[model samples]
Target: MTVNRFLIPAFAAALLGAFGLIAAAQAQTGPLRIEITEGVIEPLPFAVPDFVDEGGAGEYARNVARVIASDLSGTGLFREIPREAHISRVTSFDSSIAFEDWKAINAQAVITGAVTVSGDRIVVKFRLFDVFSGQQLGEGLQFAGTTQSWRRMAHKVADAAYSRITGEGGYFDTRVVFVSESGPKNNRLKRLAVMDYDGANVQYLTDSSSIVLAPRFSPTGDRILYTSYESGFPRITLMDVGSLRTQALAEQPGTMTFAPRFSPDGSRVVFSLERGGNSDLYMLDIGSGGLQQLTNAPSIETAPSFSPDGSQIVFESDRSGTQQLYIMPAGGGEGRRISGGQGRYGTPVWSPRGDMIAFTKQHQGRFHIGVMRTDGSEERLLTASFLDEGPTWAPNGRVIMFTRETSGAGGQAALYSVDISGRNLRQIPTEGAASDPAWSPLLP
Candidate 1:
């Protein structure tokens, strides 16, 4: 099912007020600032008290507070001080701040909030403070939604805190679409599934009767494009996420299409089409049902992705007798070879920031997830394993999630994520084996 962006009322006003407060406070006390570019060797210590229940929010208040703390701590840039070490409690949202008490516990930052539940609705308001300077980091903001959406509200609060302190966008408010697998490794059953960025709120989009691969979300997260073998051959299918309806795009009797991705505007798709035992890159206009061939060569050209501005396209080809990366105009022209490494590269994906491209490289019997500049300079391998491929970027372009498969008789595939800086590598929790992860853009 389709997941709509969370509606946080008065967010702009809150953000403005927050930044204004931070600026005023900075002028007065000049608190310590985090320079993200320099890299964080030590995580900043912070604290979060159980949010006050304004009007009987029940257990939701505590749970929400815990989730916020978890989100911040999971980033590897913040450390959560246990509540037991607290010298002062946040009994109310408007209570006087105890900067001294927090400082005694060596807490650099603190978060305080109140949760109110009325009928099925829930509202959460929170503020961030620099304990050392005794100043508010930003203006307090409130988020309101249904009780069932409490987790999302907590994530928003964490995102705001992350952005305000680090001066960067947050990726917590996004979703990932992937192929969930089960059964034996020899005969794995794969189907399309979607989940929260943290691997929560999982929902299946297709049954296992038909094998699915490379499930990609539209730019707006309202639709999905995937390759299915329902017709006994791989064919690209467009799906309305909310309705679970599917339609074939550019369907041809003798050709197969796969590895489809939506354009930045969500009005077109780029994919690989196979005909006569040869595969090439093609683009399709969704509105006009028009098709355009982007690449024509004897070598295979596939896994095409568009830059953030939609001006250029990146793909993989073996024109030089080895799979390598190439960049060309969005409309397709004489492509310039970009990758000159000592290996085969495939699945080149442009970052959301449009600064670098993440790809899968195979060399010396090992597979790695790596990134290179748009011109194929400063290449760095972020992960190496028995098998790691399909690197998809986080909403903020600071991290990548990909599929990792084990090597053995009982080997299986699972989803994994790694920071772009080559830190915080971890596996995403899933019910079973999973692969071909596709992360959607941040919710509205």
Candidate 2:
């Protein structure tokens, strides 16, 4: 996200001098644009040459380039041309462009970079180009970090490229928190765990001694809220992700608290509390330690999610004798039903963009992960299986990560992600079965 606007003019001037007429024509024209609408789909072809090594950087340079290519290609929007098919090579960061070479290979975009390693520190500088236009899409940028953080640097590069081209934010530099499960289906052991957005650098936050469920990241990404059964009853607990310190919240005698989610401003939390065998939604001020009941319905109400602007909340309830979705003011008021369909809806999560809300729907003996607008129109099921629930939105709101469980004697749950357009459904690699994934915002 760190872009150098000043360098763009200089880079464009350099390209104009190097490619002459092609660059002039490109300047007269513009960068290639792709219209992402409901229609026929075609992935844009792009190339990333192996990064040149400087100051004896060696293998790190090539590996970083490979990771960048993989990240972009995995999005299903960009196709990477193989290195063997690359007609031109990038030998230096400041080298002149060979627009004809890339144009001949039918590449619409090209990424070139150089890597420098000094002891434990590594620096990667890259530039993106419009191959056909013969113009630099953006200014050259560099990222400096430790060698151990090379993957993060590569993700940063991919995110920058994706944003500049698609005119949208990227989710590459984020994390996911979920419950990792082990043992048999009948005697499952679950613990809270977290990892990079790509499922790398996993770190367990809690031991498996107690069952954990519905792990959620705070808006700031520095804390986590989840339901734990350590005391033999589900209770909401908030933990400092860095210190691994936890403190139980909404503790009451003979009461169970669960399904906790942070407010948009991280000043309060909304969750479900079961007392006298009835579950209802309640809001708790994190700093004041005060609680307020938001719903007084006789039916069960839970899975409340606050809108991005913190003015409203979307949640699930069975007030009509069937599970359905409802929206209400954040401060508590009459709820308006938003879901009207054949199936039962639950686990409604408001999208970051404030345009759509994702949910889990059950119909015809099948579970699906789907999304619809705030007014309950344009419902589209992204995936259908024996069980696909607990949809969590990416930071950019372009993708959803959810839990998919198989149906059988050995049924298990795992994490999966799909774009909002219902394409690129893929399973995220985890060390063990995982569920209830919550994605964090882009890292600082």
TM-score of each: 0.92, 0.93
TM-score of 1: 0.92
lDDT of 2 by residue, 1-444 (tens): 545232335444442232111111122144554435433557778899999898768999899899899888878888898889987888878988899999888888899999999999999989998887788888889999999888888989998988776656888878899999999999999999999888998999999999999999999999999999999999999999989999999898999999999999998999999999899999999999999999998899999999999999999999999999999999988899999888999999999989889999999999999998899987888899999999999998888999999988899999999988788899999998999999998877
TM-score of model 2 vs. true structure: 0.93
* lDDT, model 2: 0.87
Best candidate, lDDT: 2
Per candidate, the number of residue pairs that clash is 1, 0
Model 2 worst lDDT run, 10 consecutive residues: 19-28
Tell me model 1's lDDT, rounded to 2 decimals: 0.86
Per-residue alpha-carbon lDDT of candidate 1 for residues 124-158, written as tens digits (9 for 90 to 100): 99998888878888788999999988888898898
